[model samples]
Target: MKKIKVGIIFGGKSAEHEVSLQSAKNIVDAIDKDKYEVTLIGIDKQGSWHLNDQSSYLLNAENPKLIQLNKSNDNVAIIPGSENNQMIHASNGTGLDKLDVVFPIVHGTLGEDGSLQGMLRLANIPFVGPSVLSSAICMDKDIAKRLLQSAGIHVAKGLVYTSANKGTISYEKAAAKLGTPMFIKPANQGSSVGVSKVKTKKEFEQALALAFDYDNKVVVEESIIGREIECAVLGNENPKASLPGEILPQTEFYSYESKYIDEKGAELAIPADLPEDTTKQIQQVAIAAFETLQCEGLARVDFFLTEDGKIYVNEVNTLPGFTKISMYPKLWEISGLSYSDLISELLDLAMKRFEKNNRLKNTVWDD
Candidate 1:
């Protein structure tokens, strides 16, 4: 049997660049060798795409802070509209292998904000995760919250601000509306790259400055005092949700360092202890949010479960972290799907969606 050529695209010009490398390494290590042919495509912080050797695509692979993409490889570019789904050498334009599907593990900004997805769509390649519209909607916290709220899903009360009018909303005004102890973060970033928990006016000012440094828009959300629960979702059309998990953050919040750099920053309780009805409710809400956002393939739907049993949808991660310790795959694993099998399922779903999309009429002919 012919092995499927799978391209694992990782490392990007995002704050989560190092985390992407870690996730890519885990995928490359655990992918079933007999079933699929793996190709490593690493993007540097400068946004250059390189065809890296699978054996030596990463440096300091064990250490999150130092892990980086190995740039000692041939640069490549996707050939848009190619019939064979080919990637070409950037300099010489020679043909590379035809990939059956691409699993883009790039986590933030250009990688996750529909830029790469749009490019892949134009290139006529099957890529994992959500569609361009869904990716864009989920990446922007402000837009996602609004959409979710409109659908009758509970979301944190927040105010969105851009560079143009960032000064108009002062910390005092925000406090009056959102109360003390708010969460400030970049509207379009992931992995909590520029997220901050602030209770004082000075911290709020600093947090806004830091968040704006990552993106033009910022979100100040009233912190929900509840257990941080997450549910992993999979499939297309009719998706399934994994047993919910809880995060015990050692810090004030799950900061960038806690999520990636520090190993003991948080304790994950898989299949979080909850009543049977509450668990069922979480699963239902997870799938509802996934479908509500038009997410395909997979996503990690985060929620705040209040002590009184109130649930609030936090955010949706279209491409959640896939590192060995990441909750996305771990949740699925605990729910019966192993890491390698999950990868295969995602690739299959991508191909299925691609075929279904191709069958649709692009240009209608009048009879």
Candidate 2:
């Protein structure tokens, strides 16, 4: 049996670059060696793609023994178009490898926000995660909230502030509308990047400034006092939701440091203790949001479950973390999908979606 050539693409010009490296490393370590030939593509903070050997591709900061990128003939490039799907070394223009499918573990910004997806579409490669439209929409917090609300899902009431609104929008006015203790974050970032819990007028403005530093738009949502529960979703159509998990964060909220940098920052309670009815509602909502957003392959739906049992859709991560401690794979693991099995399923889904899409008429000439 021929092994599938899989391009494990990770690390990109994103605020979550290190997180991407960690997630990709975990995938590289967990992927079935007998069934797949893995080719590592590492994009640095400088936005250059490098071909990484297996050993270095698996190295991470947490690993006391770190293996840096092999730079001897490292620069890599991809030529768009189906016939030229090969990833080549820039120096000699040698075809380092061609990918049958790509597992994109790059989180945040250019990597997750449809830029990479668009490039993959142009390259005519089957890659895991949501489609370009879904990726773009989900990356923008304000847009995602609006779309989810339009789909009859409950999202926190919020206001979107852009650079144009800088002078006009006042912290007091925003606080009055959304109340104190609001959550401010970059509309286009992930992994809790640029996310802040604003408790006062002063903090609100400061957070908005910080958020604006990351993106032109920022989202400020009224605080929802509830347990942070998340559900892992899988498949392109007729997707399935795993048992819900709840976050027990040690910080003010799940900050960026808490999510990645710190090891004991948060604890995830898989199959979160909840009423059976409430669990069912969360599962249903997870699948509904996944389908409503037109998400393919996978997504992790986050929610706020109030003490009174009210549920509000927090957000949907198109490409959630896949590290050893990440919630996305952990939830599924508890729900009977091993980490390796989940990776296999995602790759299979990508191929299936690709084949179905190819069958569609690309031009009116086919008619």
Best by lDDT: 1
Residue-level lDDT of model 1, residues 1-367, one tens digit each, is 9999999999999989999999999999999999999988999999999999977888889888788788965899998899873789988988887898999999999988999999999899999999899999999999999989998899999999999998697999999999989999999999998899999999999999999999999999999999999999999988999999999999888877877778799999998998999999999999989998999999999999998999999999999999877999999999999999999999999999999999998778956
Backbone clash total, candidate 2: 0
lDDT (10s digit) by residue, model 2, range 1-367 = 9999999888888888878888887898899999999988888778889787876554444652242333324888877774664666787876765688999989999988999999888888899999899999988889988989998999999988899877787777888888888999899999888899978778887888899999999888999999999999999877999999999998889977777667688887887998899999999999999988889999999999988988899999999998777899999999999999999999999999999999998687753
RMSD of 2: 1.9
lDDT score, candidate 1: 0.93
| Candidate lDDT values, in order | 0.93, 0.87
| TM of each candidate vs. truth | 0.98, 0.96
In model 2, which regions exceed 4 Å deviation?
58-60, 63-72
